[model samples]
Target chain A: MKIDLENLTIKKAHEAMKNGGFSARELAQAYLNNIDKDLNAFIVVFDDVLEQADEADKRFKDGTAELLTGIPIAVKNNILIKGKKTTAGSKILENYKATYDATVIKRLKEKGVVFIGGTNLDEFAMGSSTENSAFGVTKNPHDKTRVPGGSSGGSAVAVASNYALVALGSETGGSIRQPASFCGVVGLKSTYGAVSRYGAAALGSSLDQISPLGKNIEDVEIVFDCIKGEDKMDSTSIPDKIYKEAEKDVNENKKIIGIPRHFLKEGIDKEVLENFENSVNKFKELGYKIKEIELPNIEYSLAIYYILMPSEASTNLARYDGMRFGFLKEGENLLGDYMKTKGEGFGKEVRRRIILGTYVLSAGYYDAYYNKAQVLRKMIRKEILKAFENVDAIITPTTPTPAFKIGERTKDPVQMYLADIFTVPANITNIPAISIPSGFVNMDGKELPLGLQIMTPHMQEKLLFKISREVLS
Target chain B: MEIKDIENLAKLSRIELSDDEKKELLGEMDSILGFVEQIQKVETGENVSEAGDLVNVMRSDEDTHESGVFTDDILAEVPKVENGFVKVKKIL
Candidate 1:
């Protein structure tokens, strides 16, 4: 029977697999055939993809198939999949393979999900655009000339362009959601510790979360449910009680959406702002109250994120010494070996963050920069938590603008970082936030997507999904 | 940051940068640090998060074997290995 990979979702695909509409191998092949190699979304399309599909088919035949069974999912390169090449888009580990699967990967495998391939990302998940990838950039499917917002740009494109039914992307700040917004898909950044980070490459450990980007919120929720839970390996992973507390009925009268009017003050593109305003009115028309609120310390989020992210990143990345694993280069001396191997292997953005991280953590400046950022981080979290007291969720534009032309903001790293202004606060507060497609805006005759970001209190993913479904509808 | 500071950081980070990279990085460092310098304005006097809630997590001490798919395949891809040990430059 004919299969339409373009219109397939995990839930739809599951029903088809159960009814034997087509074999999992056939569905996998449909995706493989539809993959546009020029998009450069995938790092490695597993050679044994059909073999995994066949295994998933066996589960369906045996009546053991689950929601994700037989559904091919793409993973961002940073997350480990046992024995597969996991580059994290850096040249340092270009030839390196995972010794063990990430907790999320293991969970999906147990559910009989088929592994499609690993997708490209910003090297070490550092940059806003996938331009930092040591391999070539993954072009935006909407307009090939523009960037597919990143560091999970490839994962976003994989699902956006129908390369995979759904894909996994990790978030340090806005890695997952921003890309999803740019690619016109749904991205969910789960609350920190909601999912185990056992085998994913560490970036900003305090701010990092494994997120899912899908064609819709329902598909993302299905993937998120499979992966989220506490694990012995990740002590920071939250207990299941948090999920229980979050599973509450949607309250229309209690659904007050908070908008920080200050964030929309300047630099946001005109059309993007219009799209956000439209979403606000749509929610208002749907009986959801729109309240204008103030988050006092939010202005300092970008600065705080910059300081904290690099400080944590530099410390976390110290493990990549050339001696043990990754690409190695012989030098005149031991120190020289470290210098040459790292200098040659790491991309520019990674190096920048490392140096910046080292400086902030260095003597004399530590108290002023690192310590102050920590205080501000807590303040930002408290402010967001306080805002949730009166409002069920907070709303903002996912990016200041849609996907900009490639090389537009690369030269100036600060401007590139500004693209994540609205999205970074949720990562700071460890809140569950999602970017769902609001509508599209025309840019130079091309229609680019815009996203309305909804942030709820920590462990309140149910409200986030409830509100996101309303917004998308 | 100055060129001398960049040199010190490069040494600390153990990454060699060419002359051009050093100059380029020096300018970028100045701008980035200047940008993040805004955090100093935050008024965080005496209102820190409670310390008790921030204690380090410790699991019970026990001898347990780890069993997974990990194997010698990871070692096979290393640049240099000898007698099941990764080979590195002389330290002393």
Candidate 2:
């Protein structure tokens, strides 16, 4: 059997490099080889893979390697890749190259991290499944027929399929974690603004966080440490403050893990609930106290998120007119060209969201929809603040169900939106959430991964890691 | 709620939906809007929803910020360009 990097954590990969077993080029090439044929996971697998691999290999040989020097990483397309076509999986930007290295990409490059390629995502990180991508749908490696949970679908799938050892995935809601859970990999979405969003294709600016998807939690942590720092490029980035309270050893502690009793009330699949309970039981086995807690405003998160997220998406996506950087329509008038480019270029889901966003943010309904959601958005934040005060970290299912059949929910917008229900609460709160794979679905005897979303207080990422490591191990 | 509402919304969103699509969406969006309306019933307080807590994040007016480097070439690749500016279709 080929040596699967899925079994090799980042720490182990670093050790192998230290031992001279495989050079970084060989490691990166191995992943490239694995993604052969119908992996169907990448929008455009980097053409510059060999070049980056060679650079990483040289750095490894010179002994000037950072912790993740040799580990090949995929960056989500929405995040800037300098000259690469950073489409965010929308046709309008099918040719628009980024002007500057997004703050995260710049930092990672400085640390000797070789960016293998940009992974696909929902247009502007707007949807639950990668199907919303205008380029194409990214298939789950575990099961090709099912949808890879998105909008960070390509990022999670890249790591899961061992195409890249780690990938940077941005989450507005569970774009990173939900997809990571479905792909059976570890994904971390740091606190809102914890990672810089300087060059990412904006979704909900309030909720956007550029996080990491890795083969394991250790790999995720390594990438996080390298990229998680303030940058002048991102005005929203927070100054690094080592929170003392998070330094407490949580290996065997019996701290409160809040379970939002209302979160799983509706549309939860049987297998997901079973897997989630099994995960909680494992945490209990690890001696962590599980408390049935009430996040009262959690139910409204979906309603609030669809309104607020789309509102921001509308404004952010307005920059993608055909005339400037993207695929311009061949027409006479400006409005005609704009209409043709967007009408043909955008996918059904992206158009739907833009419409929803524009409707809510429009003059008459702005207060009724967008402004009301914002007021309730703070209420959701307050609910999390209150809940976290009572409990150290909150535990919930990352998504309602595991990977569904590719076309199962596509026809129904409500069903499609429901996939984001459990994940949207975290976006509402701007808290740190990590989805570590929690066993499998026993129903079909197929391995469908469940995401156990562990949310901690803002910037308490160390504590999130501590609990996540304990639970995952 | 009405075809007119969907039409109005479509115009606001800048997407041109056909009459048939508008008719279908008006019925569907009625339910979606009905669902959102329930949240307005929940008690909330005056809170300005801001993206981040960081305030006064303005750059200094000093000349030291720019190092006269523009190698990324983002502007050069624009599909329509003219004299260091991204050119767009003619505006009325």
Which numbered prediction scores highest in DockQ against the true structure?
Answer: 1
True-vs-predicted CA distance for residue A251, candidate 2, Å:
11
Weakest ten-residue segment in model 2 chain A by summed lDDT: A243-252
Give me candidate 2's TM-score against the actual structure.
0.93
State the DockQ of every prediction: 0.70, 0.54
lDDT of 2 by residue, A1-473 (tens): 35567688777777777788777777877888888436556777778877886787788788788787767889899888777878888887877788879888888888777777888888778777888887788888777888889889998888888888899988887889889988988889897777889988887787899999986777788888888887777777876554334434333353788898766778888878887888888878877788888877779988998888878888887776765567776556777777777767776777777777777877888878887888888877887898877788998888888899888987777788888787778778888888888877743556777788888888878888888888877
Q: List the residue pairs that clash in candidate 2.
A: none
State the DockQ, from 0 to 1, for candidate 2. Answer: 0.54
Segments in model 1 whose C-alpha atoms lie over 4 Å from true places: A246-253, B47-49, B53-56, B59-63, B66-71
Docking tier of model 2: it is medium
State candidate 1's TM-score.
Answer: 0.97
